[model samples]
Every structure is written in structure tokens, then in C-alpha cells.
Target: MKVLLVTQYFSPENFKSNDIAFELAKRGYDIDVLTGIPNYPEGKYYKGFGLFRKRVEKINGVRVYRSFQFSRGQNKQWRLALNYLSFAFFASIWALFLSLFKHYDCVIVHAPSPIIQALPGILVKKIQRIPLYLWVLDLWPEAMQSGGGIQNKRILTTIENIVKFIYTNSTNILISSEEFRIPILKKGNYNEKIEYFPNWSEDLLFMRQDFDIPALPKGFIIMLAGNLGKSQDLDAVLKAAMEMKNSNNIKWVLIGDGSKKSWIDDAIVKKDLQDNVFTLGRFPFEYMPTFFKSADALLITLSGEYPDLKLVVPARLQSYMAAGRPVLAMIDGAGADLIHKANCGYSVKSGDYISLARIIRDKVFSDLETFEKLGLNGRKYFEKHFQKNKCINHLCKIIDSK
Candidate 1:
């Protein structure tokens, strides 16, 4: 089967779409990607890519069609909006032109952000009368509101309308978390079309690795890897570190980069947490498994201020589980429930630094055997639910259906 995968980010930039496309290709599917220039977490364009450059290239046997889009410069709201809209406009035009000559069995839109990315997929589906599958990784206006991106009621309503249109036009919707279903259903009359499709860890890069990285600290490491952003409520983490200053055996390691890194850096110095907390800037995706293996526990957090955040199951959760480490989550709703259900570790309400510190000091640091058992449970849960092959096979079934 030939499938057109649409996303704003692709290979060499680190996104789930890369793994999904490759896995499908290995399964004997002809996959073509429609994406923008590779500029993600870092707002600038990647080296060798520019405003007008190679529009098409084959990466690892998958044909990728690149479109013109602005960079998300340093969290500037206007730049980010332009980046999102430009990709929608250019990708739709590019896909429309391509549709006149080539044919695809279906178009799968991987929506991690800027739900507007679905615009081109909708256009292709309308023009070619092929199935349009939307895989929603993040909820709209809610995420924006939580991030303090959009405050004006008019803008929020407009975005809501766009979201409704995208959901209404899609042939099927795949939600990453079970909690996303009801919220999406509230946006459009596609309840029957929506299916729960949780994301799997990037098994190729996120498995147990034997290599030793010298930078990893010796003490009980509580590591938080992935985008370090305001939404993560890292302020609470810093507060927890402050409260646990006496607990010298435990150390906190934060990996990855985002808009909030500067704030975290300042907090580390101001709060005098240099010894208890360590910040290892972003590393390549291949190095993640080694970092995970080196850590005793993985931390996942989301801001309590955003109620919608409760519905989110951060992508790193699966990676942590796949690495066979106990999870320590300061998140609520679906994310917390998943950890509890898996019996993988402990979870506290978002921003509850007191409880977070207590858990680490009492349960995690004191009981090594229980911590190991929790890690084992997480690995078992990952195998049963979040394995890449199983999830991809389920995705194939969905694509082949109807």
C-alpha cells in the first residue's frame, strides 16, 4: 500500500513520525512524507537547509517532500504562528499539485502540534477521495491557552473553528491517549470514527544499551528527559530539590532543551541546588537509552494550571517504561492513571513538591527492591501495550479498514 504521511517535523529532527514511517516501510508499504524544513525544539533551521532549498529527498528509502515554513524562533508567538500557517499553506499546495500526477491509498496526518497540519491532508482527501487519517498528539486551543500562547477570545474561537473543520473532514481520528477521546468528541461529531492509538517508544533508539556514559552521576539518579518547557512545571521540580537538600544520596538530572531552560538554569543557581540538581543539555536521540539506563528513576511532569494537561500522556512515558526504569510522575489525570495502572511507580498531583520530595526520600531512595520491582512492572506493561510492532500492526489494521 502507498501512504502519504503528513507532518511538520521529520527525520534528523526527532519525531515519532520518522519511526512510524520507517516501520511501515519495513512492512512493505510505500511511504512518502510531506513535511517542513527540519527546525524544531531549536527555532533555527537545521544546517544545510534554507528557505528555498532541496524540496524533495529520500531519507532511508522513504521519499520526503519538504515545504516552505518559517522557524519557531525562540518561542516568539508570531513566528510560531507563521511557521504553522505557512506549512499548512505550502504543504496543501504541494500535495494538490502532486495529487494531479501521483496517487496514494491514504493520507495520514501526524499532528503533534499546529493541528493546522491537517489542512493539507484534508485537501488531498477531498481532491483524491482517499481516506484521511488524523493522528492527534496534542489538543488544540487548550494547549495554546495552557502555554499562554493565545489569550484573545476571538483568536481562540477561530482556532476552535479550524479544529472543528479538521475533525469534521477527516475520515478517521487516532488519539494518542484514551483521555483525548471525549475532549475531541466535544469538538466534532466524529465520536464513532475516533480510536485510541497510544504512542509507542522509539524502540530503535530507546532500548537498553550497554555503553557507559561517564557524565551520569553515581547517586540514585532521578532523571527527567525530553522538552524542558513551562508546561512541564519544572519549577515544582526545583522546589522539590530545595526541600530535599538534606537527602544527599539522591540527585536530579534534567535533559533536553526548550523555552524554559533559561529559567531552570537561573533557578538552579538562585536556589543553591547545584549539588542536588544537574542539568545536562540536550543530547542526540541515540544517546537517550544510555541515559535512561544510567538513571534509577524517570520523572514526568505537567503543569497543574492547565486542566487540559491532565489529559496528556507525554511521549517520554513509553520510552521510560521501555528502558525498564521506575517512573516518578508529578502529573494528574490520564498520565497519573497510566502509571498507577501499570504499577510502575508512584504519582503525585501536579505541583505537589512536598509529596514528590517525600516519595523520593521515603519510598524510592530507601527501598531498592521495591523500586526494581516497579521498574520490572513498567517493562512488562510496555511490552504488552506500547511495543512498536504491536502498535504499528494495529495502525496498519486501521489503515486497511474500510
Candidate 2:
């Protein structure tokens, strides 16, 4: 079967769609990815990739068709919107012609930011007369209002309409969490075909490694990695850091780059937390497991403003669990529910730093045996639920059953 996977952001950019498409390719499906140049989160064009209407490359046996569009970082809201719209505009024209000439059996779209790529995706679906599957990582408008730092209600309403249109038109909807399915059902008349297929991290590299890195203080390290954008309340973690600053053993490391990096840097200096808090900017994805396994606890935070956000789990959550690390979450809704059910981690009040600090202190310092058990439990949970082949198999089943 030939599957055309569409996403605005893709691999070499660290988006989940890249991993999904690669897995499908491994299953003997002919995979073609329609994506823009590798620019995301930071929005700068990647090295060696020129600004052009189209480019092509083969990475890990998957044929990737890279189109060109204006790129801008997420720090500027208007430019970010333009970047998404520009890609949608140019990529749609590119795909309409591409699909007219080529035959594809299925069209799978990774809906991380829906408004950005929905036009091209839906247009291709209609033009090709193929089964369209919207694999949503984040809900639109709600995610924008909550995460994208968007406040314009009229624009939000428009995006919601587009979301409804896509949901109603698609043959199937694949959501990463069960919490995500409810909203789609509420918005459209397609509950029967809405399927929850959680994302799986590439466990081969993320799984605990035997490498012996130098140990830190006697207590455990509570680490948070990835983009610290508006949706994530990293200030809560910094607050937790301030409270635990005096502890010699408990160290807090915040890694990755985002608009909030400068804010976090300023806050660290203001709090006089230079010793207890460390911010490592943007390490390569390959090195993630080194830090994941080295830490005693992995930290996740979700801002409390968007109640609808409960429908999704951040993809990084899987990586930490895959590395056999215990998780500590300052999150609510779906992620919190998963942690509770798996019994792999403790959850503090969403955006509550005081409670998070106390929990970290207790978990990282109090009981070594329990900490080890929690870490193992997380690995077991990954093995049972989120292994990569399992997700790929489920996706194939959905396509075949349809």
C-alpha cells in the first residue's frame, strides 16, 4: 500500500510524524512524506537546506518531499501564524499537482498544529479520493488559545470551524490519547470512527543504556527536557528548584530551547539559583537517553489554563518512561490520569510548585527502594502499552479494517 504522510514539521526537526512514517515504512508500506523544510520551534532553516519551492531527500528508506515556505520562530506570534499559513498555501499547491500525477491508497496527516496544514491535507484527500486519517497530536484553537499564546477569539472560532470540517470529512480520526477523542466527537458527527492510538517513542535508542556516566550527588536528579513554551508552566519547576536549592543531592536541570529560555535565565539569576538549577540548551535528540537514564526522576509540567488540553500526552513523556526513569508530573487531565493508572509516578497539583517541591524532596531523598521500583514500573508500563511495533500494528489494523 502507498501512504502519503503529511505534516508541516518532520524529522531532523524532532516531530513525532517522522517516527510514525518510518515505522510504517518498516512494515513494507511505500511511504512518502510531504513536509516543509526542516524549521520548527526555533523556525530557522536547517543547515544545507536552501529556501526553495521544493526539495527531495531519502532518509532511513523513506522518500521525503520537502517544500519551501517562509520560516519564523514561535517567539513572534504573527510571524508564526504566517509561517504555518505559508506552508499550507505552498504545500497545498505542490501536493495537488503531486497527487494528480501519483496514485496513493491512503493519506495520513499528523495534526500537531491543525490550522497550519489542514488546508493542504484536506485538499489532497479530496483530490486523490483516498482514505484520510487525521492523526492528531494536539487539538486546534484550544491548543492555540492555551499553548500558541493566541488570544484572538474570532480567529480561534475560525480555526475551530476548520477542525470540525476536517473531522467530519476524514474517514478516520486517530488521537494520541482517549481524552482527545471526546472533543472531536462533540464537535463532529463521527464518533464511531474516532480511534485512540497513543504515540510510541523510538524505544531502541531511548531504552536504558549501560553506559556509566559520572554520578551526581547522593540524592536523585529531577530533570525536565524539551521546549519550555507557554503551554508548559516551567516557572513552577523553577519555583520547586528554589525551595530545594539548599539540598546538596537534589538537582534540577531544565534542558532545551524555546522563547522562554531568556525568561528562565533571568528568573534563575533573580532567584540566586545558579548552583541548584542548570539549563542545558538544545542537546541533540540522540543524547536524550543519556540524560534520561542519569536522572532519578523526570519532570513534566502543563499550564492549567486550558481544560481541553487534558486530551493529549506530551510525546516526551514516553521517552522518559522508556528510559526506565520515574516521572514526576505537575500536570492535570489525561497525563495525570495515565500516571495514576500506571502507578509509575506521583502527581502534584497542576502548576503548584510548593506541592511539587515537597513531592520531589520526598521521592528523590526519602526512599531509594521505592524510587527504583517506580522507575521499573514506568519501563514495564512502556513495554505493556507503548512499544513502537504495537502502535504501528494498531495503525495498520485500522487502515486494513477500514
Candidate 3:
């Protein structure tokens, strides 16, 4: 089968679509990707990638077509808007051209955010009458509102209308979390179409060999990987570290980068947490498994209270589980529920620094046997649910379904 994968972010930008496209191609599917210039967490084009750089390239035998889109600079809302809309516009034009010449059986839209990413898939579906599957990784207006991105009611309503249109048009809507179903249903008539298709850990994480990296710091490392943004509520982690400064030999290692890195750096300096807190910035996606293996526990944090993070499941959780490490979740809703259900870690209420500190000091630091057991449980849970082959097979079934 020939599949067209549409997304704003792709490989070299640390997105799951990179693995998805490669895996689909490996499974004997002709995969073509439609994406923008590789610029993501850094908010600028990657080296050798710019507005006029190579628009077409091949990676691992899969054909990739790039489009022109504005870069999302640091906290620039206008540029961010252009980054989203411009990709949608150019991607749609590219998809329309592809549909006219390329014979594709299906089009899969990877909607990580800015639901506008699905615009190209919708256009291709309209022109070729092929199946269009939308894999929603994040909810739109709610994520924007929660992250303090879009505040104007009028603009929010307009985005909601666009979301409704895209959801209504797609042949299948694959939600990363079960909780996402109701909100999407409220937006469009997709009751029969909506399927629970959660994200999976990359195959490399499972296959990676343990290697000793000298740069790894000593102490009981409690690592947090991925975007250190405001939505992650990492300030709570810093506060917990402050409280547990002299309690144990635990070290708080933060990996990845985002808009909040500057704030975190300033906080570490002001609070004199140089010894307890360590920032590694962003590392290559391939290095993630090694980092997880070197850590004692993996930390996952989300902002807000119990119901605040109900509809989404952070992709990092799956990666942590695949690495066979105990998870420490300072979150609630679906994320906490997953950890609890897997029996793979402990959870404290969001923003509860005292509880977070206590857990790190008492449960995590003191109990090695229990932590190992939790890590085992997490790996088992990952194999049963978030394994890449299983998820991809399920996706294939959905694509081939009539």
C-alpha cells in the first residue's frame, strides 16, 4: 500500500513521525512524507534546512517532501501562528499536487498540535477520495488555553470550528488517549470513526545496548526528559529538589530544551541548586535510552490539578517505560492512572512539592527492591500496550479496514 504521511514536524526534529514513516516503509508500504522545514523545540531551522533549502529528500528509502513554513522563535506568538498556518497552506498545495499524480491508497495525518496539520490530508481526501486517518496527539484549543497560548475567545472559537471541520471530514480519527474521544465527538460526528491508538516507544529504545557513558553524573539520578516547558510544571520539581537538598544523594537531571529552560536556569542559580539540579539541555533522540538506563527513576510532571491533564498522555511516559525504569509522576488524570495501572511507579498530586520531595526521599531513595520491581512492571506494561510493532499492526488494520 502507498501511504502519504502529513505532519509539520518530522525526523531530525525528534518527532514520532520519523519512526512511523520508516516502520511503515519497512513493512512493505510505499510511504511519502509531507512536512515543513526541520525546526522544532529550538524554534529555528535545523542546519542545512531553511526556507529555500532542499525541498525533497529521501530518508531510509522513504520519499519526503518539505514545504516552506515560518520558524517558531522563542515565545513569538505571531511567528508561531505563521509557523502553523503557513505549513498548513503549503502542505495542502503540495498534497493537492501529489494527489493529482501519485496513486496513494491512504493518507495519514499526524496531528501533534495545531490541528491545521490535517488540512493537507483533508484536501487530498477530497481530491482522490482515499481514506484519511487523523492521529491526534494533542487536543487543540484546550492545549492552547492550558499552555497560555491563545486567550482570545473569538480566536479560540475559530480554531474550534476548524477542528470540527477536520475531524468531521477524516475517514478515521485515531486518538492517543481514550479520554480524547468525548471532546472530539463533541466537535464532530466521528463516533464510529474514533479509535484509541496510543503512541508507542521507538524501536531503538527497545533494541539499544547498554553502554557506559562517562558524562553521566553520580548519585540517585531522577531524570526528566523532553520539553521543559511551563505546561510541564518543572518548577515544582525544582522546589522538591530544594526541599530534599540535604536529605539524600538524589540528583535531579533535566534533559531536553524549551521556552522554559532560561527560567529554570535562573531558578537554579538564584536558589543555589548547583549540586542538586543538573541541566543537560537537549540530546539526540538516539541517546534517550542510554540516559534512561543511567537514571534511577524517570520523572513526569504536568501542570494543573486532577482533571487538568485528563485528555492527554505525554509521549515521554511510554519512552520511560520502554527503558525499564520506575516512573515518578507529579501529575494526575490519565497519566497518573497509567502509572498506577501498570504498577510501575508512584504518583503525587500536581504542584505538591512537599509530597514530591517526600516520595523521592522516602520511597524512591530508600527502596531499591521495590523500585526494581516497579521497573519490571513498567517494561511488562510497555510490551503489552505501547510496543511499536503492536501499535503499528493495529494502525495497519485501521488503514486496511473498509
Candidate 4:
């Protein structure tokens, strides 16, 4: 089968979509990826790439096509919007032409806002007419509104219209959580085309691993990995760290970078938490497993408490479980439910730092053996539910059924 994966970001760029595309290629499927320059949370172009030169390269048996697009940065709202828009515009134009000549069975589009990159899939479905499966990592305008990132009423309305248009026209929609299904059904009068496709943990990264937890330090290590952006209410974690400062050995490490790093740094200095807090910014994607193995527990946090926001399923949760480490989630909605179901970690009030700190103190200090058990249970749950083969096979079923 020939598949075209549409995303604004791709390989040599740190993103889950890149790994998924490459894995598909390795499984004997012909895969082509369309993406922009490798500038992510930082917004600046990568070290080696020139501004105007777009390259076509084959990496690990997958064909990747790059094009001109604005990089995201710590800039004004319009600039960020323009960056996404430019990629959407250029990628759609490039994809439309590519589809004219190449024979493709299906086009799977990873999440793209304003329903922009999906335009090419729509074009191909209308022209050569093939199945266009949308892998919705997030529900559009709703995610924007929940994050407090989209305020312009006119623009929000426009985005809402686009969401409805794409969902209505799509052959099938793949969503991560059941919560996502509800909002789309309520807002757009969906035709029951949504399928709940859970995210998977990398087989190589997450699983039962025999690693020495005692070798690292005397204190219990809790980590928060992945992007630290506005949508991540990591401040609560800091507050938890503050509350537990004088207690038993507890250390908090934040891995990855985003718009909120400087703010977190400022908070760390203000709180005088030099001893307990650590930040390892933007490590390579391949190295994530080591950190997961090293930590005694993993932390996941979401910024807001909007009703719509509760439905999000963070990709890092799977990574944490794969490492067989207990997870501490300061998240609401469906994600919290997952933790509760696995009995792998504690799920506290969404943004309540005091309760979070208390939970950590209670879990780690009061009963050390129970803490270890939770971590072991988490790893077991990943083995039962989130293996990579299960993920790819589920996706194949979705494609075949469509």
C-alpha cells in the first residue's frame, strides 16, 4: 500500500508523527511525508538548513519532502498563525501536484489546524479519489480556545467552520480519547465516523526493563517530559515541589522545552528551589527511554480546567508507562481516567499543588514498597495494552475498514 502522511512537522525534527511514518515504511508500506523546515517550539530554522533551499531526501527508507514555511518562535500571535498558514499553503500546493502523478491508496493526515494541510487530501479524494484518513491528535478550534491561544472571535468562528467541513467530508476520523468524540458530535452533527484510536508506546522505549532505580540517588525522582507550553499547567508541579521541599527526599525534573521554560526558570529562582528542581531542555527523541528508565515516577500536567480541555490524551503518558514507571498526573478528564484505570499512578486535582504535594509525600515517603508496586503495575499495564504491534495493527484495521 502507498500512503502519504501529511503533517507540518516531520523527521530529523522531534515529533511522534515522524516515527510513525518511518515505522510504517519499515513494515513494507510505501510512505511519503510532506512537511516544513525543522523549526519547532523554538521557531528558528535548524542549524544546517538554509532559508530558501527545500530538499527532498530519503531517510531510513521513507521519502520525505520539505518545503518553505515560516518557523515558529517567541513572537506575536499573528506571526505564529502566519507560520502555520504558510506551511499549510505551500504544503497543500506541493501535495496537490505530487498527487497528480503518483498512485496512492490512502492519505493519512496528522493533526493540522484550520483544517489546512488536509486540503491536499481533500483535493486528492476529489481528483484521483482515494480514502483520506484524518488522525486527529487534537480537535481544532476547540484545542485553541481551551489553550487560551485563540481569542479573535471572527477567526475562531472561521476555524470552527473549517473543522466542521473537514470532519463532514472525511472518510473516517481517528481520535485518541472518547472525550474528543463527544465534542465533535455535539458541535458538528458528525455522522458517527469517529474511531477511538489510542496512542502507543514505542516498543523499544517503553516496556518492562530491569534497571537499577537505587543507583541514581537516595531521593525519589519524579519527571515531567514533553513540551512545556501554555497548555501545560506545570506551575502546579512547581508548587507541589515547594510544598514538599522540607519533606523526604523528592526531586522534580522537567525535560523538554517550550514557551514556558523561562517562566519556569523564573519561578524556580523565586522559590529558591535550586536543590530539588532540574531542567534538561530539548534532548534527542531517541534518548527519552533512558530518562523514563531513570526516573522513579513520571509527571503529566495540563494548564487549564476548561470542560473541553479535559478530553486531551497526552502522548507522553504512554512513554511513561512503557518504562514501567508510575505516573503522577495533575490532569483532568480522560487522561486522569486512564491513570486511574491502570492503577499505575496518582491523579490529583487538575491544578491543585497542595493536594499534589501531599499525594507525592504520602505515596513516596509513607510507603516506599507501595510506590514500587505502582511503578511495576504501570509497566504491566503497558505490556497488556500499548505495544507497538497493537498500535500499527489497529491503524491497519482502520484503513482497511475505511
Candidate 5:
């Protein structure tokens, strides 16, 4: 079978979209990925990527097509708007041209945010009339309000209308979280078209890499890996760390960089959390497993108390489990439930720093063997449910049946 994968971000940007494309190609399916320039997580363009440079390449049997897009600069709201709008416009034109030459069985879109990324696939579905499967990783206007803090109802309503249109057009809607179903239904009046399809750990995280890193301190390492953005709720985690500052042997290691890095740096100095909290900065995606292996437990947190916001799932949850470590979640809804259901580790309500601090000081400090057991449970759960091969097979089944 042949597939046309549409996404705003792709390889070199370090998203699961890369895995979906390359792995499918390796499994004997023809795949072509249409994406914008590699600029994500960080607002600027990656080192070697430019408008005309590396526009088309075939990587590991998968053909990739790049479209012109404005690089997100400094992450101002306006810059983000340009980044989304530019790709939606340019990639659609690229798709139209590509369709005249090549043919595919269907189009599958890996949509993270700005669901507008799927417009190219929608265009193809309209023209050639092929199946358009939308893998919805992030809920729209609601997420904008919760994560981006855009309170203007007018702006949200406009985005809401777009979300409905995208949902209405897709041949099938695949949601990353079960909690997202109701919102999709309300937005597009979706019926039998929507299905639950959660994310898995990046395939590389399960591989054993011989990379070495500087030694962590002589203490228990509780780590958080991924974007240090506002939605991560790191500020509350910092406050929780303050309560446990006296525990010299327990260190909070944060691994990743984002919009909140500078703010976190300032807070570390101001709050005198230098001893307990350590930011190791950003590293390559290949090194994630090594860093995760160094941690005694992996921490994942989300910022909001809103019901819909709590339902949002972060992709790192599977990566942490793939590292074969105990999970610590400072979140509610789907994420917190996953932790409890898997019996992987402890969880506290979102925004409850006091409870979070207590859980850290009490549970982590009590019995080390318990964590080992919990870690084993998590790894077992990951292999059963969220392992790459297993999830990829599940993904193919969904696409084939559709």
C-alpha cells in the first residue's frame, strides 16, 4: 500500500511522524512525507535547512517533499501565526503540484497542532478522492486557550470554526486521547468516524545506546524530559522542589530546552534551588534513552486545572516508560489515570505542589525496592501497549481498515 503523510514538522525536528514514515517504508509500504522546513520546539530554523536547501530527499526508502514556510522566530504570537499560516498555504500548493505527477492509495496526516497542517491532505482527498485519515494529537482552540493563554473569544471562535471544518472533511478522525472524543464530537458533530489512537514512545528510546554522559550527583535523580514550556507546569514543580530542598540526596534533573528555559534559569538563582534542581540543558534525541536510564524515576507534569486541559496527553509519557523507570506524574485526567492504571508510580493532582512535594519526599525516600518494582511494571506496560512495533502495527490496521 502507498501512503502520503502530511505534517508541518518532520525528520530532523524529532517527532514520531518520522517513525511513522520510515518504519512503514521499511515494512514494504510506499510512503511520501510532505512537510515544512525543520523548525520546531526551537523557533528558529535548524542549522542546515533553508528555503531552497535540501528541499527534496529520499531517506531510508521514504520520499520526503519540503515546502516553503516562515521559520518561527523567538516564538512571539505573531511569529507562531506566520509559521502556521505559511505552511498551510505553501504546502497545499505543493500538494496540488505533486498530485499531478504521483498517485497514492490514501493520505494520512500526523497533526500535532494548528490542525491546518492537514489542509494539504484535505485538498488531495477532494481532488483524487482518496481516504484522508487525520491523526489528531492536539485539540485546537481549547488547547490554544489553555496552553497559549489566548482569552479572546472571537479569536477562539474563528479557530473553532476551522477545527470543525477540518474534522468534518477528514475520512476518519483518530484521537490521541479518549477524552478528546467528546470535544471532537461537539466541534464537528462527529459520529462513527472518530477512534482512539494514542501515541507511543519514539522507537529509538527502547534501543540501548553506548553514549556516556557526565555523572549525576550522589543522590536520587528525579528527571523530567521534553519541552520546558508553559504547559509543562514546571513553575509549580520548582515550588515543589523548594519544599524538598533540604533533602540533599534527591536531585531534580530537567533535560530539554524551550521557551521557559530562561525563566527557569532565573528562578533557580532567585529561589536558591541550586542544590536540589539541576538543568542539564538540551541534548540530541538519540541520547534521550541514556539520560532517561540515569534517572531513578521519570516526572511528567501538565499546568492546568481545566478539565479539557488535563485530558491532553504528552508524548513523553511513553518515552519515560520505555526507559524502564518508575513514573511520577503531576497531572490529572488521562495522564494521571494512566499512571495509576498501569501501577507504574505515584501521581498527584495538577497544580498541587504541596501534595507533589510530599509524595516526592515520602514515597521516593521510603523504599527503593518499591520503585524498582514499579519501574518493572511500567516497562512491562510499555511493551504491551505503547511499544513502537506494536503501536505501528495497530496504526497500520486502522489505516488499512479505513
Candidate 6:
């Protein structure tokens, strides 16, 4: 079958869409990816990728059609909005043009942020009379309000309408979190249209990748990897580190880069957490296990303001599980439920740095045996539920079903 997979981010951008396209290709399906030039959390074009450059190519057996998108410079709110709209506008142009010659059986949209990327798939579906599967990793206006700190009801309502339109046009709605189902149904024409589909861990995560270790502290490291963004509540995470700054044994490390990098840098100096905290910027996804190897515990955080955010499970959690590391979460709802279900590690309520610091001191610090046990439990849970092939096979089954 010929599939047009659409996303604002793809392979070189370090998104799971790359995996989906490649896996489908491996299954003998012809996959074409419609995506923007690779600029993401860093908000700059990746090396060798730029506007009107590398617009057509093959990557991992999938033909890629890159759009001329505005790079999200430093991801300021206005710039982010432009970045999202540019992809929708340019990619829809591609959709309309490609429809004349590319006879795709269906369209699949991988939505991380700016689910607006699905605009092209909707256009393609309408033009080709084919189904559009919207795999939503983040819920829309809710995420914006909670993560972006957008409180203007007018703005949120507009975004909500856009989300509804996207969801309404999607033939199948696949969610990364079960908690997302109810909220999405209220806006979309969803009646058995939504399916609870979770993200899978990368195969490389299960196998250790050999690499030189970065300058991580030689102590009990509590590491947080992935986007350093507002939604991650890194400020509060740093506050927790401050609460335990005198502990001397536990260290806090942040991996990955985003708009929040400067904020985190300022906070580190202001909070006097220089010795207790370290920030190692972005690296390839394959190097995760190597970074994780030095981590005594993996940390994941979510801000508490938006109830919608509670529905999120932070995709990095699956990689942490696959690495067999004990997780330290400052979150609530489905994400916390998953941690509890797997018996992975202890969690404090979102925004509760006091309890989080207490847990780090009382539970997660220097207890090698307990860490090993919790890590083992998490690894076993990942093997059972999130193996790459198993999750993708289920997705294919869903796609092939009536």
C-alpha cells in the first residue's frame, strides 16, 4: 500500500515519525513522508537542512518531501506560531500538488506539537478519497495553554477550533495516552473513532550503544533527558535540586536543548546549584543509553497548571524504561499511573518539589539494591508492553481493520 505520512518533524529531527515510516517501509509498504526542514527544540535548522534545500530525498527506504518552512528561531511564541503555520501552509501545497501524480492509498499524520501538520493529510484525504489516521502525541489547545502559558481564552478557543477541525477530518484518532480519549472526543466527531495507542521504545535503547561518556557528575546522578521546555517545569525541578543542594551526594543533570536553556542557565547561577547541577545539551538519540548508563535515576517532570497536561505521559519515559533505570517523576494522572503500574519508582505530585526532594533524600539516594530492583521491574514492563515491533504491529492491525 502507498502511504503518505505527514509530520512537522521527521527522522533527522529525532521524532518517532521516523520510526513509523521506516517500520512501514520494512513491511513492504511504500511510504512517503511530507515534513518541514529539520528545526525543532533548538529552533534552528539542523546541519545540511535549510529552506528550499534537500526538499526531495530518500531516507530509510521512505521518500521524503520537505517543505520550505520558517525555522523556529529560539522558539519564541510568535516564532513558534509562524513555524506551525508555515508547515501547514507549505505542506498543504505539497499535498495538493502531489495528489495529481502520487496515488497514495491513505495518509497518516504524526502529530507531536502543532498537530496542524495534519492539515496536509486532511487535504490529501479529501482529494484522494482516502482515510487519514491522526496519531496525536500531544493534545492541542490544552497543551498550548498549559505548556505555553497562554491564558487568553480567545486564542485558546481559536486553537481549539483548529484542533477540532483536524480531529473531525481524521478517520482514525490514535492517542498516546488513554486519558486523552475523553477530552478529544468532546471536540471531534469521535464515536469509536479514537484508539488508545502508545509510543514504543527505540530498539537501540534496549541495546547499549557504545560511546564516550559526556561530562556528567561522578555522583548519584538523577538525569532528565529530552526537551528542556516550559511544560517540563524545569524551573521547579531546579528548585527541587536547590532544596537538596546540601545533600552533596545526589546530582541533577539535564540533557537536550530548547528555549528554556537560557532560563535554566540563569536559574542555575541564581539558585547556586552550579556544583550540584549540570546541563549537557542535545545529542543524538542513539547516545541515550550511554548518557543513561551514568544516571542513577531518570527524572521526568510536568507542570501542574493545566489539567490537560496531566493526561501526558512524556515519550521519554519509555526510553528510560528500556534503559532499565529507576524513574523519578514529578507528575500526575496517566503518567503517574503508568509509573505505579510498572512499579518503576516513586513519584511526587506535580509542582511538589518539597516532596520530590524528600523522596530523593529518603528513597532514591545511594540505595543500589532498591534502584536495581525498580529498574528491573521497569525494564520487564517495557519488554511486555512497549517492544517496538509489538506496538507497531498493533498499529498496522488497526490500520488494516474495518
lDDT of 6 by residue, 251-361 (tens): 899988876888999989988889988998888887898888788899999888789888988889898899988999999998899999999988889989999988877
- Stretches off by above 4 angstroms in model 2 are 204-219, 362-364
- The residue-level lDDT of candidate 5 at 399 comes to 78
Q: What is the lDDT of residue 198 in candidate 1?
A: 92
The best candidate by lDDT is 1
The C-alpha RMSD of each candidate to the native structure, in angstroms, is 1.5, 2.2, 1.7, 2.7, 1.5, 1.6
Steric collisions counted per model: 0, 0, 0, 4, 0, 0
Weakest ten-residue segment in model 3 by summed lDDT: 204-213
Alpha carbon deviation, residue 118, candidate 6 (Å): 0.8
Candidate 3: residue pairs that collide: none
Which parts of model 1 are misplaced by more than 4 Å? 204-214
**Cα lDDT tens digits for candidate 4, 50-167:** 4555468788898888867887667467777788788878887878788787888888888734456677667766676888888787777876776546768998889888778788
Cα error of candidate 6 at position 97, Å: 1.1
Give lDDT: candidate 4, residue 297: 81
Tens digits of per-residue lDDT, candidate 2, 274-329, equal 77777878777767788786787888888887876666788888877788878899
Weakest lDDT window of 10 consecutive positions for candidate 6: 203-212
Candidate 3 error regions (>4 Å): 203-206, 209-214, 305-308
Give the alpha carbon lDDT tens digit for every residue of 339-376 in model 5: 88888889998878899778777776678788778977
Off by over 4 Å in 4: 51-54, 112-115, 204-218
Whole-model lDDT per candidate = 0.89, 0.80, 0.86, 0.78, 0.85, 0.87
How far is 307's C-alpha from truth in model 1 (Å)? 1.5
lDDT by residue (96-209, candidate 3, tens digit) is 899899988999999987889999889998898889999998888787787755679999899888888988888888989998988887776689988899989865455665
> What's the candidate order when arranged by decreasing lDDT?
1, 6, 3, 5, 2, 4
Find the 10 residues in a row with the least total lDDT in model 4: 206-215
Model 1, 229-343: lDDT tens digits are: 8899999999888888878577899998999999999989998889888988988877888888778889999998987899989899998888888999999999999999999
Clashes of 2: 0
